[model samples]
Target: MLEHLGEKLILHVTLGNFSFSFDILTVIMSWVVIAVLVVVALILRRGLGQDIEEKPSRTQAILESLIDLLKGQLMSSFSSDKLARELFPFVSTVFMFVLVSNWLSVIPYCESPTKDLNVTLSLALLVFVMSQLLAVRMRGGIRYLKGFLEPYPFMLPLNIVSEIAKPISHSFRLFGNTFGGAILVTVVSAKFAPVLVPAALNAFYGLFVGAIQAFVFAILTVAYINVAVES
Candidate 1:
């Protein structure tokens, strides 16, 4: 059944007790996504002028608008403007990276990295680590750890379990939706000779469903950060 998955997918590596594996396609495709974003950023940067009153180029305006949107979203989460600004780079980067990764499936020779369990889990784990660090930094270490016992000391274990589950749940939600979409499209395309059907399916899956998952993942990261930093 896995034979239908196009190209060389997984590669395993081992070194003593440290065993590791990754999707070969995901790694290659993610670089392309990053390069494209970097190029767009450079082009947008070129359009900006030092003079405030000068009219901005379309690319500059669009980039500025996106930044504004991200800023507003982050601002809504944090009480401190400085903290919000500090977190904007992380939130915005995740949003753009995931968005690009998802949309790339529409192009030939590219697949959404988010479809890979490893990729989604790694992304989710990043949020988990950052949120925990933010909590420790904002609230003192002892206070942050002690907060798990809130409302009752007996809840500590349950709270810790729930905290651990956040990343697992976050990762699987994206991986399942994206992986399932890819599998369904593949199976249907292989069985049907029609070109239009597969094209439409790809379009809907790549654009609508993929984009929604990316947006949710990015926004949820910010939401988790908010919960972490909240007093």
Candidate 2:
């Protein structure tokens, strides 16, 4: 296990003369997370088939609180309630997916998808693209373009560089934290203390840190949207 600390299982395919290498572990783990979320969503949807309840069940109460929390974060940044309502599905999904991905480490023999740079970077890029599109939508194209030159004409290049750095920084922050936690757990568990130590570390890193990182990522995504529209 120690020998394979950072190694990935690659799946290679050849189509005619071209060959493609894919990180099979990351892909598999990512899909596992997605499938789990899908199943949960289906169950929840079926539950919704019941008549509306005046007083919420425990599960419903918890879910409502979570929704309000995410919505409140969006509403705080976006003054328009309609915009917040529209954006809730996306932001909430992001939070749930990431939170689940991070928590994957808690399961025995399962690793978090976020431990892979590709996964985190892809997520960051998705948010980056969405933010750019939102900016263009909320502030007209001309105004959005003009944002790069604000305060001083010479600031355009710097602004462009800043925009380019967002995804890089966003992705690396998550990748580093999750990957580092994984490595820490692996190394300590393999070479040092046994069951109890590893269990404690896994709970702390996989659950607590995972939840915090997910929330941070979601909040940063919302912050990017706020900057996009209000910049």
Candidate 3:
């Protein structure tokens, strides 16, 4: 069944040592998610009212509610209102992007960007850099390095290893989950060749896997930021 899928619906793009092969439908589906996000951002920025007198539309109200929910989560983690305010945009953007990407995979023939190792790695690296920068900014240069020594001198090496492992784990967790889902769906569709079966699988993908991945991504971001700020 898997072998048959390789011949039927596989999408391939190659450059030098790097090559990507997946279902073309999945690739296009992923991009549609990206496109939708871009459009939503633009629309919200333009349509949101500048003052209380100009009431926001229903769409704007819904967007604001989502942002407020994220804000509340960040606030609970940060403890400092000022810090939460400052960090809100970055955290919010990451949550929305990951949430959308995960949910997009449920669309028939669509592949999630998070399913690609390269894309997930890039996002993890960005978060790693941002976390380090936040740590340095909060504790200063030398203090940031000294942070590893906290609670005991003997634990420094272990702490260092854990820090390095963070990005690797973060990237692979997301990549593996989404990629595995995509592969499972592909194999199932090929084997069953039944319309309703794929739909049921997609419902599970959208309702369960998508929501869990989104929550995990957001919570992890908050946890990492809390570590950086509190260290």
Candidate 4:
């Protein structure tokens, strides 16, 4: 258990003069999270094909509630219903992926992909790129470029720096929380009472903190895109 704190199982590959390496555990856990989300999405799709019932089943209720929740969040940020609907799929997918990835740590012998900086960074970069592309599409390329010169010409450098920092901060925020929680849980389980204390802590950190981090990441993605497309 103590070994789980900071150690990483790294795999290296080499071909002639080229070399590459990656964290094996993070890669496998990420695939596992993706597989879980895919299965759930299929289940939801199958459920949707059924005829409308007078009363919703548990699965139907849960699906409707989750969709409503995500839609509400998007609507709060976007004044245009069409725009909100357009962005819903990406934002909701991000929320589900992050939530599932974060929760993976709660399973025995399984770790969260978000605990790895690479995984979180990839997700953050995806959001950043998507927002930028949408901005350019909504605003002309010249207008998008001109956004950096807002208020004063001298602010261009500052604006550029701020834009660069978005993915860094976004990725690190989720990575720090998830990684720190894993370390704390491992230490408690190894040093203190292994059963009760660790279990309680895992529940709090895995479920509560994980959900909050996922929500924050999703909301921030929406907010960033909103800012990009706004005049």
Please give the clash total of every predicted structure, in order.
Answer: 0, 0, 4, 0
Worst 10-residue lDDT window, candidate 4: 46-55
In order, candidate lDDTs are: 0.84, 0.86, 0.77, 0.88
Off by over 4 Å in 1: 6-8, 12-21, 73-75
RMSD of 2: 1.7
Using all chains and alpha carbons, the TM-scores for the candidates as numbered come to 0.90, 0.93, 0.83, 0.92
**Per-residue lDDT for 26-131 in model 2, tens only?**
8888899999999987666654425574556666665667667877764567756676778888888888888999999999878899999999999899989998
Q: Please list all clashing residue pairs in model 2, or write none if there are none.
A: none
Cα TM-score of candidate 2: 0.93
Scored against the true structure, residue 223 in model 3 reaches a CA lDDT of 80
Residue 133 displacement in candidate 2 (angstroms): 1.2
Q: What's the CA RMSD for each of the models?
A: 2.5, 1.7, 3.7, 2.0
Residue 95, candidate 4: alpha-carbon lDDT: 92
Tell how far residue 220 is off in model 2, in angstroms.
0.4
Quality of model 1 by C-alpha lDDT: 0.84
lDDT of 4 by residue, 8-119 (tens): 8899999999999999999999899889999998787766636665567777777888899898875578755777889888889899999999999889999899999999
Ranking by TM-score: 2, 4, 1, 3
The lDDT of model 2 is 0.86
Evaluated at residue 47, the lDDT of candidate 4 is 62
Q: Encode model 1's per-residue lDDT on 166-202: one tens digit a residue.
A: 8999899888888778877787778774578877888
